[model samples]
Target: MTTSLKLKDLSKKEMLLAPGHRMCQGCGAAIVVKMVLLAIDKPVVACSPTGCLEVTTCISDYTAWKIPWIHSAFENAAATMAGVETMYRALKKRGKISQDISFVVFAGDGGTYDIGLQSLSGAMERGHDMLYICYDNGAYMNTGTQRSGATPFGASTTTSPAGSSVPGKMQHRKDITRIMAAHNIPYVAQASPSHHLDLMRKIQKAMSISGPKFINILSPCHRGWRSKSDDAIALSRLAVNTCYWPLFEMDNGKTQLTHTPKEKLPLKDFLRPQGRFAHLFRPENEWIIEQSQTQIDADWNAMIGAGAGASGVIEE
Candidate 1:
């Protein structure tokens, strides 16, 4: 599979997401979200949970969103989107609102994988025709870089600070794709900013599918991760190459990897770039790297097993 994706071919129109936003330099979430909105031209109603995206896009008296948007609490984006979907369907039945509108809920990893998991699960279990997108920055970036379920092993966060004995986050990152797939939804996929074209393609696929679709986007954060502003795309690419974040999709029923690295890079190549794992580079912090690699190996093995009967990894 080609790592060099044609992200701009999906839509040739001018950028819908304008400039002068409050997002920090090299913020991967901003670019990915922009491409997400650009993937579909139909009317859209978005339910956003409280997080960095919400805070930056919906500041007091300042709105950068071009589509119909609703600001909900941190843990209720799924529920809010459910209500909006219900209302839209009801209105369409009554000939009060058009049926062409698409409903999407955007939340952070903390909101989707932890606090909002119940509501999200409920919405998916109930089979709502909506898309739930989780921008996995790997921690609670808005309040603080606290250790969330999405935080990778050995990465340091506010809640998982390194100490004399404790290296960093002790737990492995949650397997969100598998968790969503277990819901038996129509679609579930993982994407990253490095593969913008593929990301947009999956967004369109999710929108067209009935029932529910869940997307876990690996959006790197410069502020929280202590990475360089210009290394966003490089970091994103390294994450996939290192198997720290795999790119794949679970279609109507079949699961397949979207991209398999030509050569798997070491976990250190992925972790050492960010200051979050800087402590892990110390002489005595070798255990952190070893544990991290073990976790990645386990995940890739499980993915291979689950997709054994399916076709080879999907090509662009």
Candidate 2:
């Protein structure tokens, strides 16, 4: 599955997700869906849990998805897709289904990290042939921007508000990609919309695999993060540059860093722009900023020790 898909080549492919859906301006999740769909050439069957993507794209008979799409509950997207894939396999064995249809589940971090973690684990453990994509926008952006398991530390949310009493969410975000990698699946990668080509290449690689594959994408939420609508891509890039989010993949039991910054930028470059971390920028909260930077540095060092560096290749 070696594909050098230029942007012009994507325009030539038919889009499975049509425009005019009710996604917010510059929604990273929407772009992820588009890019994923464009990367695959096979017939797709998409399953989405209860989240912004499901709600916005599917509204009572008027669907924006040109491909066959299913809207599942908040916690059963992976299970549902696994069931569908199982049935497809049965049909194919019985000579009823001829086409090689691919099954993909798109869920928010709330679904993947918290609500649907068990189901995702079950599907992966069962060795289901499917792709699970988690569009991680940090907090639960669909239902009032509440803090979820994926929300970063010192970030304000409705449930974890920044005020005189408390800082934002006190806990660090879950390393879901690592967790999934522990499943020993064939492919597990972390991606961001900022690097379109890298993301597309990972998606292609995931599609080429025959077993369970997972990709955790750091999708920025404009409304939830209190950032400009047009700044989603910029924020994503800063996330990579500051080493807040390092792009990597785990194959078998080995981990490899896919992209490493040439000259890593300061954590402030990524934190200062988003209002969620605005509280940390205060004079009194300088300690929080220091703590955050220390944590980032520690995580980056660990990732590099695990093999990410100038070459961006980590062989276990």
Candidate 3:
């Protein structure tokens, strides 16, 4: 039987990620963790690399995780999880273990898009039975908010400050979702915390499938983004509404748009709330907004042309 996602039922599940951690107030990563752990029906062993989520949840002598969790380095989360899963399979083959367990690796943008990219690619290439989740908050928010590969174009970071010399990051954000899809993994998806049901459904779907499954979720960092802590959900939803982050999945090799904006909002609506892009509002930098929008339009249309919306929308 398929796992039911009714909110009432989900709320009854034991909280795998307990509260009282040191995650920045209103950090979306915490919400992502809760949603992911709640959706899984089987016992899961999760691996989190050294980042905000890891440091905050697995503090000295105090752990917020209820399940078996592993703490990996900033650059080896995927590799570590791969080894764990490999051993489980090896032991099960020898009839040393009987219970079915799920393996998951959760990392941030810095760990997934840049630092851990090599390990992540290797894990997927090897076809390990594990689920990798990237809660992309754009920059390296955990460590002084440095610029990361996943940081959006023209968004200021510590390394790419919006100053007279330069205006935020000059290059566009790297598309890690497509990179993972290129591996022909069993599942690859991009979701957001604002769509709780959609995110939970995707998690459950990934857990059901064997082999490496990747889900890239857009999370919000209040301190880094200079936005109101309470605006995290609205900011996340604006990303989807602006087409900055589409809710889609690549099942096998086919792409499907899970949720498309009913009426696409302007990119400014997404950027206006965040201080990272505050400079873009200046008269001199107005052209940057134009360029960003043009690029976004092209990418969205290309996805449609490439069959992203071929199967129809999943509806948020």
lDDT of 2 by residue, 1-316 (tens): 4445788878988888989899999999998899899998789999999999999998887999999989999999999999999999999999999998889999999999999999999999999999999999998898889999999988999999999988888888888988998898999998888888888888888888898999999899999999999998899989988988888877676777788776799999888889999999889888877887999899889987876544443221
Clashing pairs in 2: none
lDDT of 2 at 126: 99
Off by over 4 Å in 1: 1-11, 308-316
lDDT of 3 by residue, 181-233 (tens): 99999999999999888899899989889999999999999899999989889
The TM-score values for the models, in the order shown, are: 0.93, 0.96, 0.98
Model 3 segments beyond 4 Å from truth? Answer: 310-316
Give the 10-residue window scoring lowest on summed lDDT in candidate 3.
307-316
Query: Residue 281 error for model 1, in Å?
Result: 1.5
Candidate order, TM-score descending: 3, 2, 1
The lDDT values for all models are 0.84, 0.89, 0.92
Query: Candidate 2: lDDT of 153?
Result: 88
Collision count for each candidate, in order: 0, 0, 0
Higher-TM-score candidate of 1 and 3: 3
Off by over 4 Å in 2: 1-3, 310-316
